[model samples]
Every structure is written in C-alpha cells, then in structure tokens.
Target chain A: MKSVVVNNISKRYGSKKAVTTALRGISFEVDKGELFGIIGPDGAGKTSLFRILTTLLLAEEGTATVDGLDVVKAYKAIRQRVGYMPGRFSLYQDLTVKENLDFFATIFNTSVEENYDLIKDIYSQIEPFKDRKAGKLSGGMKQKLALSCALIHRPSVLFLDEPTTGVDAVSRKEFWEMLRKLKEQQITILVSTPYMDEASLCDKVALIQSGKILSIDTPEGVVRSFGKKIIAVKSSNMLNLLADLKKTELLEDAYPFGEYHHAVLKNESNEHELKNYLQQKGYPFEIKGTDPNIEDCFMALMKN
Target chain B: MRTLKFLLQKEFRQIFRDPSILRIIFIMPVIQLIVLPWAADYEIKNIKLAVIDHDRSDYSRSLTNKITASGYFILTDYTSSFEQTLGEIEHDKADIILEIPASFEKDLVKESESKLFMAVNAINGVKAGLGSSYLRSIIQDYNREVRTEWIQFPRFSPETSIEVTNSNWFNPSMNYKVFMVPGILVLLLTMVGSNLTAINIVKEKEIGTIEQINVTPVKKFHFILGKLIPFWVLGLLVFTIGFGIAWIVYGIYPAGSFLTIYLFAAVYLLAVLGLGLLISTYANNQQQAMLISFFLMMIFVLMGGLYTSIDSMPGWAQAITKANPVSYFIEVIRMVVLKGSGLADIKYQLLTILGFAVLLNGWAVVNYHKRS
Candidate 1:
C-alpha cells in the first residue's frame, strides 16, 4: 500500500514584488513500512515539502494524501495518524522532559505509562534528567526527547525533518539506528535532511534542488546513473592540482573530494595520459581510478 | 473534553512553575487592590488658609474661627500684609487667602450689607474650587448667625430659616474610596486576564510549539479555550483575593449581591480574554502581543470611567464606551458595590457583556487556523 502520495505539489511565498518558490512541482511516494528521504542542502525546499505534507501549510498546486485520506479534506484524521517533527525543535522549552512527554501523551488521550513500551528505548536515555527543562538540555538529549514525544502516540506514518541537523556525529549515528529499529515495527517514515551522507541510510532518496527534484533512486541506483569515468588524484600541491587538472583538455571535471580530487575523464582519455600530463608539471602525484559516489551523482544531476 | 483537560493541566503547571508569572498573578493583585484606592482618592482636603485679617473686629474673628473649625482648611499663616500673602501663594504655601476690610464690623452693624475681599489661588482647580466653596458656605452661616442675633425669628427660631437638608443616598458621606475600590477592582481583573492570555498564546508561537500543537487533533476552539480558561480561573481567583483585600484594607463590602458581581465579572472576563486571544492570533510574537495588549489597555482603562465620569464625556467617547467591555464591567461593579443595584437593574449591562463575549470569542476562534 502507498502510505503517502504527493503529486506535482508546488508552494510559493511572498507578494508580487518578490516571490520565493519553496517547492516546484515535486512528486514522490512512500510505500508502507518504507523509509524515504528527501535529500538537499538548506534552502533547497526540504522544509517546505515537509510542511506541506504534514498539513501545516497549503501547497499552491497538486494534491497529497496520507493513507487513503486527502490532505485537505481529512486534516483532522490525518493529524491523528501522522507525526511531524519540524526542522526546528518545536517542543515547549519551558516544560521538563517528563512533563512534556506526559502532556503530549495526555492530549492524545493516552498516558506515558501506556506508551512506555513504545518509547522506552529513546525516552530512557533522557529519563534520568527528565526533571530538567528542555531548554537547558544538550542538543542530542533534546533530539531524543522530541523523538520520544513524537512516537508516544504511535503515529502510523512519521515525518522527521532534518532530525539530526545539529546533532553530534555519535548521536547522529545512534539516531539513524533508532530509525532502523522503528522501520522494523512496520511504520512508514518520510525523512528530509540537508546532509547528503544521511541519504544512503534511507531505502530511497530524492535529491532536490531549488524547489525541483533532481533525481529519485536508491543510493546505488543514483551512483550507477553517473555515466562517467572518474579517478581520485592526490598531488603534492593540492590547491594548484585542481587548476592544472581543469587546464587539461582530456578531463571533463575535477573537484576536490575529501583527501583527493575526483576527476571526471572524457571518453577518449586514458589514465596514463592523465598521469603523464600531471607529472610533467614538476609535482609528485598519485592517481587511481575510482567509483562514482552519491555526491558526484548529485553534482551531476544538479548541473542538469 | 479530555484534551482540554490535559491542556489546562499543562498550562496551569507552566503558570505555577514560572516564578515571575506567579508574582504577577497572585501577589500583585493583593497589593494593588489594597493600596491603589488610597492613592486614587478624589476627595479634596487640607486646604491651606492664609487669613489676612485687615479688620480686627469681633465679627472678623468669629468668621475666621468658623472657617478654621470647618475641618476642611488649616490656618497656615495669619499675616496682615497683602504682599506677604501673595508671596505665600507664589511659593505654593497657601491655597486660599481671606482679607476682611477695615471697619468691617461697623459696616455690617450699620450697613447690613458688606463686602469681604477674598483672594484665591486657583492653580489646582479642584483644590481651589472646593476650598473657596467651603469657605463661602462657612461665611454665609456666620452671616446668618449675626442676622439672627440682631432680630429674633417669629416662631420657629433658626429651625424655620428654610433649612436645606442634604441627603447622600448611596454613599452617605460620598466617600471617594467607596467609589474607587470597586472601579480599581475591575481594572485589576482585566489587566491580569487580558495580559496573561495574550502572552500565553504568543509565547507558544515564539517558542514554535504552536506548530506542534496545531498538528494534533485539538480543535481550534478547544485549543483557545484550553489556553484561555486557565487564565479565566486565575482572573476570578484574583478577583476573589482583590475583593477580600478591599474589605480588609478599605472596609468596603459590596452592598449588592455577590452573585451579581461575579456574574458580571465572569462574562466581562470572558470578553476581555477573548479580545486578548484575537490579538494573539494577529501578533507574531510575544513582544507584539504585549504591545498590542498594552495599546488596548491604555484606551480601555483611561476611558473606562474609573477616574472620569462617563456622563461628562463627549458624545462620541460615550458611544465608544458602550462598545468597551472594560467600561461595562467598571460601571456594573460600582453600581453593584456602591448603589446596591441588583441583577434586574444591571441586566442590560450583563447582556451587552454577554454579546461582547460571544462576538469576540467567535471572531477569535474563526481567525485561528492550524495552517498559517
């Protein structure tokens, strides 16, 4: 079953003098129990799409639905069935961890004791400091408490928007692990993130740019579609290396990636020709042919 | 119903947990209701009388004694120099000066009609008007005594001199504190209700928690009432504490039914809280909400007729007050407390307030949407 369906949705803001289009004809779907990701950088309309899906904002065009229910017509039912954690930490900062949890539970007509089993793993991490105000907590602890609150009602479809944006690497890893556990419980998850690395963790990822979806595929599928030969090169002069690589007519693109620069080659070029051209420049270098990663594919799709 | 109960519980816990709001809610009302009435008094007293007695006759002395003994004015300085008295007026030392002309006793004995020169400092208009009027009344009584002594009355003596007895019906002595205590009580309830309600909703918006709540199944009206009813209960609690403080400090007991006062207060508080919610819906943050609430409060309190009488206002201002929820409550509280006006007498005011309650709350609910 399609747990979520968004078709050609567009959203714009501001008046005629200056208009900002946050989402442009975006279309995607999340199957039952599948974890889907909308991956992009900031200002790439990730937040806008999440807001439209969660029913917090109206899309200028297109239609969306949760389960079999329409987003606009069945908003009340959709609210009960869906959990949305916005990009910003939207919890009551003045409320303590325990109070905030219980409050959300009670408002949903359940109590913390009843949902203790569902959120025990996440909530127990912060339960030791449950009396502390949420504002005073560290960023990672707040993320845990917020996720616990979002799950207290056991929403059928969870919408987590940039959940690990400010979290440290250790907590970010643990948070993705928690999502993996949630996925085993057969809950459909639609998560958006500006972090490209987190995209691989989702079953399927949609790379969006400037309110437009660049590509939608599995991480491997996106990488397979790069359609270019590439080589990772390291030179003694890393800064001057990119200019020299771009200066070569045999290369299509050369951009820095981590410790080395990944250089895309034209069809006629060979590794020996590239290496010999760089060595004649009086620089010590090493070159090895490599696989195209999602980042490379994203840059390729973004250019088009 | 259960959702609202949980919301109210959360709100009350937050209200109690914040020490700053606790001081504003519980402690501030008691101090204001007890202390504000004394400072807001309208009764004028302690007029400084500078008696420049140019005539050193027995009648002049008698007139001076009567003015001093009236308990309104104090004999500040009994100087004979007119220049000294003028210097006193300039220095703000004396408010009234009495100068009796030379041979004033002989003029009254021979000429039955005599004139007394009186110089009054009229800068503080209420003090000056009241002081002069009190002095004139005392002088007239002395004049009647002198005339009565010269010629005896026919049968009734001083009793039949066309005695114009004045009776103050509601407030026997026309106590300014009695009139003011009720008015200030209305003001205290309104300030607490409207401000807390406005800031409560806007604080949620500022903290971005309103979006979280909006995504819930909570209805708009339920959300509004859940946020507002806690303040409503707190407003009534403040009213109760204020009523007790008024009785303890000022010894003022509402002459009418307590039910009537609470009845009007309940409706009036709903209307004011409704207005606050409407403002919160339009305001984007707590600072904007505070500014808007204060803007409405200044207009409501000043024109609510707490210090100024509505009858003396211009036609347009009076018409505005008719739509003012604060003024309706202020008038009802005073009428119920000071005049013992019952529900039957104030039914019109109660109905107007009920109308405002429905209208403002309905508008607020309609304007509040989960989607921005």
Candidate 2:
C-alpha cells in the first residue's frame, strides 16, 4: 500500500511581479514501511515538499496524502499520524532533553513509558544528559534527541528534513543504523538530504534538482541508468587532467573524484582510442574501467 | 484540554527558569507603584513671597500675615523698595512681589478704592499663576473681614454675595496621589501582559521551535490559551502586589469591593495579551516583535486615559478610545475606587471591554497560522 503519495504539487513565493517558483510538477510516492530518500542539493524543493506532506504547508496545485488521508483536506488527522523534524533543530532550546520528550508525549496524549521501547536505543545514549538544555547539546546529540522526540509519539510515517546534514560522520552512520532498525519495526520513513553517499542507504531514491525530479529509482537502478562506459583516471598533474579531458570533447562529462577523475565517454569514443590520445599528449596517467556512483549519475542527468 | 495542560506546564517552567520574568513582574511593579505617585505629583506649593509694604499701615501688615498663614507662601524677603524685590525675583529668590502702595488708609476711606500691584515672575507659569490666585483669594477674604468690622450696619451690608464651596467628592482633600495610584496599576498590568507574550511567541519562531509545535495536533486556540494562562496568572499576581504597595506606601485602599476591580482587570488583560499574541504572529524575529509591541504600547499608554482625562482629549482621540481597551479599564477602575461605584454603574464599560477581549483575542487566534 502507498503510505505517502504526492501528485504534481507546485508552489511559488513572493508577490505577482517577482514570484519565484520553488516547486514545479513534482510527483512521487513512498510505499508502506519503505525507507525513501529525496536526494538533492540545497534549494531543490525538498523542504517545501516535506512541509506539504507534514500538513504544515499547502501546495499551490495538485494534491498529496499521508496514510490514505488527504494532506489538505485531512490535515488535522495527518498531523496526529505523522511526525516532522524540520531542517533546523526545532526542539525548545531552553528546555532539557527529558522535558522536551515529556512535553511532546503529553501533547500526543501519550506517556514516555508507553513508547519507551520504540526510542530506547536512541534515547538511552542521551539519557545521561537528559537534564542538559537542548541548546547546549552537541550537533550529534541534538539530532539524537530530536529523533527521539519525533518518535516518542509512535508516528506511523516520519518526515525528517535534512536530519543528518550537519552531523559528524560517526553520528551520521549511527543515525542511519537507527533508521534501519526503525524500518524493521515496520515504520515508513521519508527523508531528504544533500549527501550523495547517504542516498544508497534508502530503499528507493529520487534525484531532484531545481524544483524538478530528474529521476527516481533504486540505488543500482539509478547507477545503471547512466548507461555509458566511464573510467577513473589520475595523473601527476591532477589539477590539469580535468581541464585537458574536457577540451578533447571525447567524453560526455568529467568530474573530480577524491583521488582521481571520473570521466564518461561519448557513444562514438572507444577506451583504446582515448588512451592513445592521452599518451600522445604526454599526460602520463593511470586509467581503469569503473562503475558509476549516484553522484556521477546525478551530474550526468543534470548536464542534459 | 490535555494539550493545554502540557503546553502551559512547559511555558510556566520556561518562564520561572528565566530570571527576567520574575524581575519584570514582581520588582518592576513594586518600584513603579511606590515611587511613581510621588514623582508624578501635580500639586503646586512652596511659593517664595517678597512683600514691599510701603504703606506700613495696620492693614498692610495684616495682609502680609494672612498670606504667610495660608502655608502656600513663604515670606522670603521684606524688601524696603519694589526695586529690591525685583532683584529678589531676578535671582529666583522670590516668585512674586506684593506691592501695597503708600495709600495709608486715606484712599480706601476717602476715595472708596485703592489699587494694589503684584509683580510676578512668569517663567514657571503654573507656579506663578497658582501663587497669584492664592494671594488674590486671601486678599478678598481680608476685604470681607474689614468690611464687616468697619461697616456694621445690618441692613446696609452686602446681601447679594453667593458662597461657592468645593467638596471635591470622595477625595475631599483632592490628593493627586489618590488619582495616580489606580491609573499606574493599570499601566503595570498592560506592560507585563503586552511585552512578555509578544516576545514569547516570536522567540520560539526565532529559534525554530514554533515549527515543531506547528506540525503537531495542537489546535490554534489551545496553543494561544497555553501561552496566555501563565502570563495571565503572573499579571494578576503583579497587580495584587501593586495593590498592596499602593495601600502600604500611599495608604490608598479601594472604597469599592475588590471583586469589581478584578472583574475589569481580568478582561483588560485578555485584550492586551491578545494584542501581544497577534503581534507575535506577524513578527518574524524577536527584534521585530519587540518593536511592534513598543509601537502599540506607546499608543495604548498615551491614549489610555492614564495621564489625562479622555473627556479632555481631542475629538479624534476620543473617537480612537472607543476601540481602546485601556480607556475602558482606566475609567472603570477610577469609578469603582473613587466613587464606590457598583457593577450596574460600570455595566457599559464592562460590556465594551468584554467585547474588546473577544474581538482582539479572536483576531489573534484567527491570524496565527501554522503555515506560511
């Protein structure tokens, strides 16, 4: 069953003469208990779409529903069913960790003990600092507490907007692990992030840019859609390798990978011919055939 | 109802934890109510008098004695000449110089009239005007005394005189502090109610906590009520402190029942607090919220019938007070306190203020959106 569905939703801001479109003809869905990721750069309409799903904002056109309830018509019911963690750390900074939890639980007409089992793994890590004001918590600890509060009410679908954006690598890894555990509990989770490496962790991922969805598929499916032979190459003059490759016009796109550069070839160009051209140019380099990653796929899609 | 309880608990905890609320509510009222009445006093006294008694007659000496006996004037100098008295005024030593001309008793008895000159320093107009008026009344009283003593023909005496006695009802002594105490109490309640709640919601918005709450199942009115109740209770507590200070320091006790004053205050707080909430809804940050709160408070305080009577205000200002919740409370508070007015006497003011409460709070609830 579809746990969340959005259909061609659009939104714009500012006055008549100066309106800027934030989202345009966006449509997607998340199945029951499926961990879905909306991957994009900043200003990709991720926050706008999350707000629409959480019933905190209304779309200018089209419709959205959460758990079989319309986002606009059944907002009050949707609010009770879903939890939203905004792009910012939205907990009361002046409040302590324990107080923030208790407050969210009470508003949902539940007690912390009632749902202690759901958030025990996450909350226990921050339990020692329960008396500390949330404003004083570290970035990683704050995210943990925010997630604990978001889950305290046992929401069926959790909408987390950039939950791991500013977190450290270790905490980001632990947070994803927590989400996987949550998936085991049969909870549907929809998240948005700018981190390309994190995109592979979701059951399904949608590559969005400039308020439009470029593609939506599983991790391997998106990499497969790149559909061109690519090579990772590095040379002594690493800085000039990117500029020299682009001038050849023999490749579709060239981007700097960490230690090397990933280059995709055009349909007519062969790897043997490209190697001969590189040797003749006196640019001694090591090159090997490689599999495409999501970042490469997103760059390829954005070019067209 | 359960949501309100939880929200209110969090609000009260935050409020009490922050020491500023305690200072703004408790210490502020006690200091303002105790010291403001004494500072804002309009009763003019301590006038310095310079008497140039050229006549040196019995009547001139008696007039000077009468002026000093009134306690309004202090005999600062007995100048030998009017020029010396003018010098006294120029140095600010004397406020007025009373010149009893060298007529002896000859002009009043023979010519039936005598002109007395009074040279007054007009720099501080209110003091000078009051001093001159007091001197005139005393001299008139002395005229009546001399007339009755010298011309004691019963049938020929003045029969057309009309005596006008001022009772200055309720406050027969007409103490200005009695007038200011109640108005200052209303002002204290207004400042605490408007500024605090305005900053409360905007602070949440500034820190992004409002986003968390907006995404919840809490109703709009429930959120507003949660914000209002804690401050409402605090406003009442401060008001009680102000009332106690008024009595302890100024000896001003309400002649009317406490219930009547509370009735107006309860509704007045709703109106002012609702206004604060409405301002917070539109403000994007704490600085913007603070500015808007001050903008409204300046209007409310200046036009609230606190410093001046609404009747004496310009026609346009009087029209604006129809919608001003502050004016209604100021009027009702004074009525109940000074005149011992009953509920029936203040029914119109009470009903109008109740309407203002509903209108402003209703606007606040309606305008406060969970979305952009």
Best by DockQ: 1
TM-score, candidate number 2: 0.87
C-alpha DockQ for predicted model 1: 0.68
lDDT against the true structure, per candidate, is 0.89, 0.89
Chain B TM-score for the candidates in order: 0.91, 0.86
Model 1 residue runs over 4 Å out of place are A111-115, A229-256, A259-290, B45-163
Considering summed lDDT, which 10 consecutive residues are worst modelled in model 1 chain B?
B154-163
TM-score, per-candidate, Cα-based: 0.87, 0.87
**Fnat for each model:** 0.87, 0.87
Residues B158-204 of candidate 1: C-alpha lDDT, one tens digit per residue:
46346488999889988888888888888888888888888989989
lDDT by residue for model 2 (B1-372), tens: 888889999999999888988878889998898788888867667899999988888878888899899999999998669888899999999999998889946687778678788889999998888889988998889888877787766775456777697778889889888878999899899889988999998999888888899888998889989999998998898899999998898898888989999988988888888888888888999899888878877888889988877898999989998877877888888888888898899999989888877888888888989876
